[model samples]
Target chain A: MSGRNATIEVGATSSALVALIRSEWGKAWSVRAPAACLAGAVLLAAGTAFTLANDQVRAMQTGEIPVGTLVPVAEILASSVMFAQMVVVLAALQLVTPEYASGQIATTFLSHPRRWVVVLTKAAVAGVLGGLTGLLTGPLCVAATELALGDAPRATVPAAEAAVMTAGVFACAAMVAVALGFLTRSGVAALSVAFVLLVLTLAAPAATGKVFPGVAGSALVSGTGDPYARWAALLVLLAWVVASVGAAVVSVERRDA
Target chain B: MRIDDRARRPAFRTFVGTGRQSGPVIVVPMLQFAEISKRYGPVTALDHVSFRVEEGTVTGLLGPNGAGKSTLMRLLVGLDRPTSGSATVAGHRYRDLRWPLRVIGTHLGGRPVHRRRSARAHLRSVALTHGLARARVDEVLELTGLADVAHRAAGGFSLGMGQRLGLAGALLGDPAALVLDEPVNGLDTDGVRWIRELLRLLADQGRTVLISSHLMSEVQLVADRVVVLGGGRLLADTTVAELAGRARDEVVLRTAEHGADDRLRALLPDAAIRPVDDQCDDGAWRVTGASEREVGLAARGADLTVLHLARETADLEAGYLTLVGDRGQQVDSVEAR
Candidate 1:
C-alpha cells in the first residue's frame, strides 16, 4: 500500500543510545522476574536483620550475653547488603538471558546493529536498577533491626556513606552478573555461577580468616578492613566488572546474531 | 546486468512528504549483492551470487527449500555476514546504516515476537530504540489490521495473526526498501490477495520490494521480475514472461485417419511428434515445432479430418520445473559418470 506522507528522520547516535537505554529499562521491568527479585531481596534482608537483633536483645535481657557485645544496627544493615546483592545478581542475569532465550536479541540487534551499544545499554540499565534497589533496601534493613532491638545500644555508621557504599557494591555485582549473562547467554548457567561465587565469597573469610582479593563482600559489608585490603578488594571487583564486560562486548560483536 | 541511475530513484517521492532536492539526485540500487558467498564450515549456503534490486519494482526470490533464500536474506539484514564479497543497501552495509529501519524494513520467517509482550508494547519498545514517535506505532498497528488486538499478548495470536504482526513490524519505519521472507505463509486466501496488492502498491510507489517464496504461481502473479535459485546456485534472473517464453510450447492435434500420426511426422520433419491415446475414436499427436494453423493445414493435405488442434502455452510452473528438474538430472548424471 502507499506509505503515509510522513518521513522519519534519523536521530543522532547519542540520541539513539539514549533511546536504547530507555528501551532496555522498559524491557527490564516488563517482566515479573526483576520485581520479584527486588521484593525477595528486601524481605530477606529485613527478616535476617530483625532475627539477629531480636536474639541479641533477648540474650542481654536474660543475662546470658553482655550488652557491650551486641552488634549495631549499622553492621546488621551492612551485612544485609549481601542479601540485596544476591537479588541484584539474579535480576541482572534475568535481564539478558531471557532476551537471548526468546531470540529477541535478533530484533534488538536489528534495531540497533551496534553490538557494543546493546551490551552497554543492558548493563547500564541493570546496574542502575540494582543500585536503586540497594539504596532502598539498606535503610529498610536498618529500621527492621532498630525496631526489633528497641532501646539496646545500636551500632551506627554514617547513613550517607553506608548508602553510597551499598549502592556501589550492588551496582558492581550487577555489572558482573550482566557480563556473566552475556558470556553464558543462559539464565540457569549464569544464575548458578553467581550463586556459587556469592556463597564461596561469604564462606571464604570465616574459613581462612581472610577473603580472596577478588571478593569485595567482606570489605563492602564491614567497611573496617585495613586500607590496603579494602582498596585491593575494590580494585579486584572493579577489574572483574571491566574484564568480564569487555569480554562479553567482544564476543557479542564478533558472533552472528 | 546493470541498472541505470535514472531508473533507481523513487517514482512516487512526491506522494510521500519527503522534500524534493534542487541538486542532481545520486541514484543507487536499493539493495545490491555483489559476488556474495556464505559458508557454514564445510557446507556452503550461497555461492558467489550476484543480483541488484532497483527502486519501484517487485523482485521475487524464487527458490525451493534449502536453496539459500534465508541465508541470502540474513546476509542482507546483517544477521549473518557473508563469508566473502558484500551486501549493501543504498550503498551502505546494513550494520553501518545510520537509521536501519528508516532505510530498509525486513521481516524474516516465523514469529519473532516476545510471547509475553502485548503487540503494541512490543512495537513501542522497538520504536523507542530508533527514536521513532509513538504515532508511528499506532499507524502500523492500524495498517496491519492489528489495532483491535493491539493490547493483547502476542502469545495468544494465531499463525495468520503472527504473520500480520511481523508485517506490521516491517512497515513500522515506512522504509523505502522492504525485504520479506515468505510473507504469504499461513495467510488465508484474502490475506494472500491483500499482501499481493500491498506489495504491488509499494513497488508502484518507487520502493524496492524483494520477496522470497517457493510458490511459483504466487510469484508469477505479483513479481515484475523473478530471480530463481536451485541448489544454492543462481539459475535464472529474468521477468516472469521471459522465463515462461524460454520454455517450449506444444500444439496437440487429433485426426480420424489411422496413419495420421506418421503422416504429420513426415509432413513436419523438424517437429517433434509424439502419439497420445485419449480413449477417443481418433488418436492424438503432440507437435512441438509447428504452429496450430500449420498442423491443421497438414492434416487437411493428408485428407485427414482433424478433431482437435490447439496450442498449450508454457506457464511459470512448467518453466521453473523444467529448469530445476533439468539441473537435478545433470547433477545426477555427472555423479554417475
Candidate 2:
C-alpha cells in the first residue's frame, strides 16, 4: 500500500466512450468465437458475389443479362446482416454477463460509479462496431448484384441510391440487435428476442406480401421486395434500438449492480 | 470538507478521567456507518449495525459465517445498496466519489479476477479507469509481488495467486482506505506475513483499514480494534486490549507426581482436570476465577511437586470463540432456511 494522493477527475465523456469502444473491439478481435462468426458471414457474402460475377460473365457472352440483376446482387451483402448481428449480440452478452457472474461488476461500478455510463458505453461500442461492418460489406454485394443483372433495365433510381439504401438496412439491423443485447444481458435471451422481432417485423412482413396481392398486404413490406425497405423500416428499427438501449440504461441504474 | 485540527485528535486531556462521554464529538472517523441495515427477503442480513473505522488502526469486522461481513463490504463499495442506511468513506458515500476505484479500494472474497486475462491486464483496467499512468499498474504488480507471473493468465494461478491479483487490482489506485473480506483465506504463511506487514504499513500512513475475517488469530495479530458480530448483530465492539480484558480468566496447571491430581482435585474440587496424555505422564488442570498463588499454596500443603503452573489470560481466539463460535452451531440452521 503506497501513500499516494487520491485524485478523482471525472466527466471525461466522449473520450471515455471512445476508450471503451477500442477496448471492446480489441477483445472481440482476440476472441475466437466472434472472429470465426465474422469470417463466416464475410465468406458467405463473398461467395454470393463470386457466383453473381460468374453469371455476369455468361450473360455478357450471350448478351442477355439485365440491369435488374444488380439490385439482387447488392442485396446479397445485406443478407449477411442477420448472421453478423447474431455475432455482435453474442459478443456483447459475453462482455456484460461475465462481469456479473465473475463478480467484476463491483470492480466496474467502483470505477465508473455512474452505472448508466458503463451500460451505455457497451451499447455504443456494439452499435458502432455493427454499423462499421455494414459500411464495409455493403458495396461489395451491390457490385456483385449489379454484375449478375447486367443490361437489365435500370429503375428510375440511380444504382448508387439503391446500394446505399441496401447498406442502411444492414446497419439498422445491427444497431437493433446490439441494443437488444444490452436490454437482455443474456446471450440466449437476446438472440431469441432479436430473432423473433426480426422475423415478425422484417421477414414475416415480406412473406405476407408474397401471399396477398394488394395494398393491404404490401403495407407489411416495402414495394419491389428490395433488400432495403424504404426509410420507414429503418425508422422502426431505430426506434427499437432506442427503446432497448434506453431500457437497459434505466434498469442498470435503478437496480443494484 | 477538510478535517479541522481540533477534530484530528480530540484534546486527550478532555477525555481523561471523564466518566461520561457525550454525543457527536467533532472527530473525523475514517469510515462512518450510520444505522446501516440490509435484508434479503424475509431474512434480515444486517440489522441496524453501526461502527466507525478510525485512521491508523486495523478495524476487524469479526463475525461467524453469514454474519453479514460480506454484505457490509459490498455496501461500502457500492456493490449492494443498504436497505435503509448509509455509509460514508472519507466523508462521502463510496459510490458518490467521482472515481471510487481511486478513493476506496476493496477485495471481496470469492470475487476473483478474470481467469482468461493476465494479472497485468486485471490491474491495468483499474489503473486505466482511474486515469493513472501505466507505470502505476506495474508499481502495484511489483508491490503485490506478482511481477514474476504478471503475464500469466489468472485462471492457471493458485487460489493464493488469485487473491494476490485481486489485491493488486484493489491497490492499483493507492486508495485512501482499504476494505478486504477474508483476505487471508488462501494465503501461505509467508503470504500471510507479507499482508500483515503491508496492512500495518498502510495503517501507519493514516489510511483506514477495515479487514473482515473469521479467523480470530489472524485478526488478533493484525487488528487494533475488533468488532464481533453474531446472528447479524453487533456483539462486541472494542479495542484488542479491551476485548482481552473482558475475557474470562482461567488458570492452567500441569504436573506429574504420585496422586498429585487426586490431591489437587480434592483440595479444589471445583477445578476441571483432564488427562493430557494416555500414559498420564502429563496432567493438566483448569479452574476459573482461581489465582495461581492459591493453587501453589494448596499444592505446597498437599506435598505435590508442581512441574508447571501458569495463569493464562484468554487470547483473541478464545475471546472470539466465546463470543461468536459459542453460538456458531446455529449458523447452519440460519443459512439453511
**Which candidate ranks first by DockQ, i.e. highest?**
1
* TM-scores for chain A over all candidates: 0.86, 0.66
CA error at residue B296 for candidate 2, angstroms: 3.6
- The lDDT of model 1 is 0.77
Which lDDT tens digits does candidate 2 get at residues A1-257?
33334334334466555544554554444335555554554455555655655665566567686534443333333343433444544544555655555666667677777677777666665555555554554555555556555665323233354335534544444555555555665657776886666543444555443221121112212234443344444555556667777887877776666
lDDT (C-alpha, whole model) for all candidates: 0.77, 0.63
The positional error of residue B42 in candidate 1, measured at the CA in angstroms, is: 1.3
What's the number of clashes in each of the models? Answer: 1, 12
In model 1, which runs have C-alpha deviations exceeding 4 angstroms?
A1-12, A55-67, A72-75, A204-214, A226-229, B1-26, B250-312, B326-337
Tell me the interface RMSD of model 1, in angstroms.
Answer: 5.1
**Candidate 2: regions farther than 4 A off:** A1-41, A48-71, A143-185, A199-229, B1-28, B255-283, B300-311, B327-337
- Model 2 chain B: which ten-residue window has the lowest total lDDT? B9-18
